[model samples]
Target chain A: MPVFPRFTALAESLPPTVPFVGPEAQERTRGARFIARLGANESGFGPAPSVIEAMEQQAGLSWRYGDPENHDLRERLGAHLGLAPDRIVVGEGIDGLLGLIVRLIVEPGTPVVTSLGAYPTFNFHVAGFGGRLVGVPYRDDHEDLDGLLAAVKRENAPLVYLSNPDNPMGTWHSAAAISRFAAALPETTLLVLDEAYSETAPVSALPDIAALADMPNVLRFRTFSKAYGLAGQRIGYVFGNRETVSRFDRVRNHFGVNRLGQVAALAAIEDQAWLSHVIALVVASRDQIGDIVRGHGLKPLPSATNFVAIDCGGDGARARTIMDGLVSRGVFIRMPGVAPLNRCIRVSTGPEVEIDIFEQALVEVMAELNGL
Target chain B: MPVFPRFTALAESLPPTVPFVGPEAQERTRGARFIARLGANESGFGPAPSVIEAMEQQAGLSWRYGDPENHDLRERLGAHLGLAPDRIVVGEGIDGLLGLIVRLIVEPGTPVVTSLGAYPTFNFHVAGFGGRLVGVPYRDDHEDLDGLLAAVKRENAPLVYLSNPDNPMGTWHSAAAISRFAAALPETTLLVLDEAYSETAPVSALPDIAALADMPNVLRFRTFSKAYGLAGQRIGYVFGNRETVSRFDRVRNHFGVNRLGQVAALAAIEDQAWLSHVIALVVASRDQIGDIVRGHGLKPLPSATNFVAIDCGGDGARARTIMDGLVSRGVFIRMPGVAPLNRCIRVSTGPEVEIDIFEQALVEVMAELNGL
Candidate 1:
């Protein structure tokens, strides 16, 4: 069958691909469920009991469309963040919000800056909008702040993405260093500071809200998918200067955010105790993963996020072989897409049972690789 | 506070406004909630008990991110629609899907055609993408198929939108008429056939799936939001020739659909009995509305949708008075934005109790207007 031939050149140029192939897709292909789902950094610990109850209680109310403005949730989030509600815009997810931000700022040939192997979804959005990406390489497994700033300056890029407590490598910079980097950026540059893992990070790794609230060029993206454990809900928000944040309103599907997600996110916020419990479990899981990798003579990178990146003492090819072995054994995990970073396999902190599976799979995979 | 100055010219040109102000926003402003929510055409009858049960059952598993590929839901939908899975693409909602289709085809200065007063969300997306819209006015109360075809040919537009069993006016064309309209459109023009109200319409109002199945340029959009009563879940899908449907994958937020929504939609599809019940109730409610309007000396347009568009036998100002009076009396309702259509007020078919409130309120409002 012939495809409709009028899609814009930009749309036609984009490869029909997802940034990450979900574990569900893999299960269908493999014809078996993964014994461990540590690939997507989802909180396998599950949502709070209170949140589940709230969802159950309100599931019948799913007949009404969600409040297009996301009023109550935004009001609560405003109270939580110490900013006015206007400063925040709730969206389907951080990925969806990233796409909107890119659409607002990027035109064909527009320059965007980010770490070479940073969040692939952000890059996907930039490319979707026909933006030219200028990637700065990570230094020492950390998103190099100086390198990103230099590239922004060199390319005069309007948009730059920085994920503190970054993904893939599971690394972070102190809040002070991040604040310095934000302060050094040109006013013309819009910084997308993703803090999806903020709840799992040390308190000092996140900047004071006041430090960046005044800057129109910086929008911080956060979500309930990590420590709060509502990844399937698809609720994420972006906040900054009201003006910068309001740009989302112009193009967003006003009723796009699902109803139960708002209910779950609101309930999750009210259950801070549950979040603290999840964070504690995450810390223990991280330590357990560190020990497990060290026992196999691998180096585990210190992480502030909900996952650990363990160096396999080899290159990307070796990491791929180990990852493949684990996958064949029904253990799901991921690795960075680029060279040095790809040498490290990433595993999410989750329930001890799932982590046990990961540990067992890692041992057998390592033994098999040693034999080879 | 300073606004971010680096947004693209197109983004800067667009206004920050919602296509429709939700009843929740109005209630917030009014400092009171509407006792009867007949606006926005949401089913106050609510979702199926089975769907609610399914959501409750899966509430705890929300910790895992939704299947990014929407594999299972798409598979079930494909079976339901008698199409191959590759021909269907699910997204956040039909609204979200509409935005994606517009983005895929529309670019700066691209000419797009649609009914002048049809779904505002579609228009919002066109303007967001900097596409110039050529709106053909409605003929009588229904979308003018011939007028739209003329506009498409005149502008050499690459895209056109048609919502069967139309909104605001609650009128429709026969399936034969719609099929002919699709066949007549240029192959270069992609037709976004929104069937959001399909389940509520007469059997003859919808073309057989096979009627337009082979046309790459015809993509039919449907949702669980209306007769299925899953509006708040935000799940909608589009299907067409495999090659055409696949384009959505290139630009969509792969993980945008929520977890419970997928479950709810799956269960809703299984509960055909409940859907039949809702449709019967909607029919009764529509008749109830028609009677109520006629008793008040108003004209209710013949409807194939889950709403009644009642003409007040006056102009837009008179209709506004009646609508505002109903809202003030806590009976939420809406009207079309443009001319002759605006002479009518739209009320969604909902539960009998809400319709009771609407009837009482309309009686009082009309009496007051007459006295004035």
Candidate 2:
């Protein structure tokens, strides 16, 4: 039978493909689990023990819906960020929050600017809302700030996205430079500053809360998925000027965030010592990955985040082959989708045991590919 | 400073008000804890102990994002329902799923039909997407199926909503009546069949899966939040024609469901005995509530679901006063928002301890108000 024919034209035009094929899907397809999960950049270090305990303690309370307003978690997030509670809106992770902000701002054929090959999920949301995406190619392996600003101005784009301590390439810009970029944008343009990797980035890589707190055009997105090790919990928040941030309330599913996620996030924030400890481990793991890749005669990109992007000394095709070979060899890793950046493979930092497996798998895969 | 100026006109036009204020928000406003939690229709008996144990066991693995496809849960759900896995789509919750389906079909000025005093969250989504809503008033406390069908034909509405074992009034239509209603709908009018209360509803109240499974335009939404007592986990599913259900994947946030929630829901489904136990408790509690209201000259509506809506034999004003009086007396109960239905106060079935508190509070409030 024919499907319902009344879906919006834009919905009909959209493709059903998702942004990422998760590692779990890959295992199902391969019919074998990977020995090391270094893809997706999730921390194998896991959430804090205290956070787990808190989740366990409240497991029986799952019958109660999460607070629709997310009062307590937002209050805690406010104090943590030195902003008022009204400035923050917690959601089902940065991805879910991205969809909401896009819905609030985007309309059919509206131009949205972003670095080419940046977060695909953000791009997916733009397309879902019928926004025309203007891609600014990277400059010298970094998001070209000048190019992005020019596109925003030329297209009169109302939305732009940038992830600092960036993903896939593991590149970053100084806080001062990021602040200058934000200042240059027209007030009508809303900047989505994704800081999903902030906790693992160097101190110099982050802007102080007060620097961009008053910018009505900027919403900084952060998540516990990275250094905080709660990607599975799906807790992400965006904070900015009260009026601008409050626009989210106009369209968000008020009770969207799961209850135990709120509980776990609250506990994760309170355990700063655990965060610090994880950051240290991530730094060491990044170095270990760097050393391992270099020993195999590959270039490791400088990284501020938990993952290292190893230059495979070839193009996107070569990178794909190596990544596939590693996957077949029981290693789970990823690579950039677009060219230039795609010349490298991205591996997340995790426990030494997992890294050791990645090292062994990489060695065999490289030798096999070289022989071919 | 002003907020960003380029938000879409529809978004700017939307009110920032939410569909419902949570009980937690009420407690914050009153500056006191509720003595009896009976509002929101969440199960007070909580999730099955096995579900809780499963959540705790998997709490440490929360660093990994849940399978973007929800493969395992959907597989189990498909087997349980005797439907193919492709016909089911799992999402953040029924609220989140409603938002997605609405986004798919409801463009600006799209006509949608529903009962006057139905699920407000569904209406909230329709408004969020700029859909024009046509409300058909309930006929004698039950959804007016004939009125709804006439409205759909008049408006040529692309979407219609019907919740069985209905909310606020605790009434239901038999399987035959509902099946006939679905058959009467235009092929182009997609039906959103919400069965959130199905587990607590009598067997005669629900249609067999085969009865409407072949209809391309009918989507039945079910939830773990009701009888399974996993409201806080925010897991809900919609199953229907594979082609129609697949449309959700075009825009859904793949990782929106939290990891532990998926684990908890899976465990909850596996423990069918606990579900039966909770249903029994809800029936007894409903009877207890009926006795308490009848003892005071109030009339209890016949209920197939886990709540009782009591008629105060007056107007909305009287019902409001009694509801407010109960609130002040530390009993948390709710009433419908529209007139006619507003003359009745709704109390959710719960543990006897909480129901006992509600009974005592209601008696004192009635006596005090009568004296006044």
DockQ (Cα-based) for each candidate: 0.89, 0.92
lDDT of 1 by residue, B200-260 (tens): 9999999999889889999999999999999999999999888888899998998899989
Candidate of highest DockQ = 2
lDDT of 2 by residue, A157-180 (tens): 999999998876899999999999
Listed for every candidate in order, the interface RMSD values in angstroms are 0.9, 0.7
lDDT of 2 at B351: 94
Clash number for candidate 1: 0
Q: What is the C-alpha lDDT of each candidate?
A: 0.93, 0.94
State model 2's lDDT.
0.94
The collision pairs in model 1 are none
Alpha-carbon shift of residue B123 in model 2 (angstroms): 0.7
Q: Show model 2 residue runs off by greater than 4 Å.
A: none
Clashing pairs in 2: none
